[model samples]
Target: MTIHSSHPFLPPPEDRDPVRRLRGRLPAPVSVWTSSNGPIRGGWTISSMLVADGDPGELVALVNEDADWWDLFRKTRLACVNVLASRQSRVSEVFARVAPSPGGPFRTGEWVDSAYGPRLADAAAWVGVRLVDADPEHSGWGLLVRARIESVDLAEGRIALQHLGGHYS
Candidate 1:
């Protein structure tokens, strides 16, 4: 009676996981995860994030452990998820370390300080969050960070960037 049982080509229930092959099949929005604490500024391109359901609402980001943002995230315990506009693919590429931008990634995009952290000036939207927990050994991919949303800034942008099949869509 369920689609899962009817689809023979689908992965078995237990085998269904966030494996790269599976994730690659799903489209995820591109975002630049940024954080700062007066002195240090760090950011990286991320596609694994979501606004989770809860009181006060929450944002969860799965950050690679080797990313520079990891330490800044810990130091600040705060961050801003800047949802990229479709035209900002270059900015995403710079942060993803895929392309060279003059003066580096920070210089590739306009940035401004917000109450929670630094946010992209031209982002489609931005969500500020304060770290509630960080699980380092989660899913063998990266740190699982759950944060409480503190602020949100929605701007005017129609086209949003998405990542799928190893490319931006």
Candidate 2:
């Protein structure tokens, strides 16, 4: 006797975080935050960020507290925020650890070393910053990163990559 259920075996979908799902709907820049601590180099893909205008200006971002990149960033307290181009989604995915980058993400991208850190050679724009560690609070799962914008570089007519709804927009 041969018997088989009409539906294929499958597990029910897991409950998704409403906050994360909702946040995903909002468009954000595809930025890579990079830092160099001595000989160690680290980078992380970050879209949870904001820019505040002031005398010195400020850029605040939420960073994964547990990420190795965060540890490296904390050491130097300085980093470069590089906004990727619209055509550089693969670079973002690589830095995000969502794609397989055999030699590492930096290996595939052109980079220029600066006072803050390594900045993407062809980024749409870049911001150099020094971390403000006044508050040690965690926002949800990320550590609240407040930075003083040290420098800014803008490239005209370049489209920046935007992420929304779990995909690039």
Candidate 2 residue pairs that clash:
none
Q: Backbone clashes in each candidate structure, one number apiece?
A: 0, 0
Q: Which stretches of candidate 1 lie over 4 Å from their true place?
A: 1-18, 134-136
Assess the local accuracy of residue 120 in candidate 2 as a C-alpha lDDT between 0 and 100: 93
Best by TM-score: 2
User: Tens digits of per-residue lDDT for model 2 on 48-150?
Assistant: 9999999899998888887678877888999999988888888899888888888777886898788898989778999999988944589898888899999
Q: Compare the candidates by lDDT and give the number of the best one.
A: 2
Q: How would you encode candidate 1's per-residue C-alpha lDDT over 25-73 as one tens digit per residue?
A: 9999999988887766788898888888778899777778888778888
Each candidate: what lDDT? 0.81, 0.86
Could you estimate the TM-score for every candidate? 0.82, 0.87
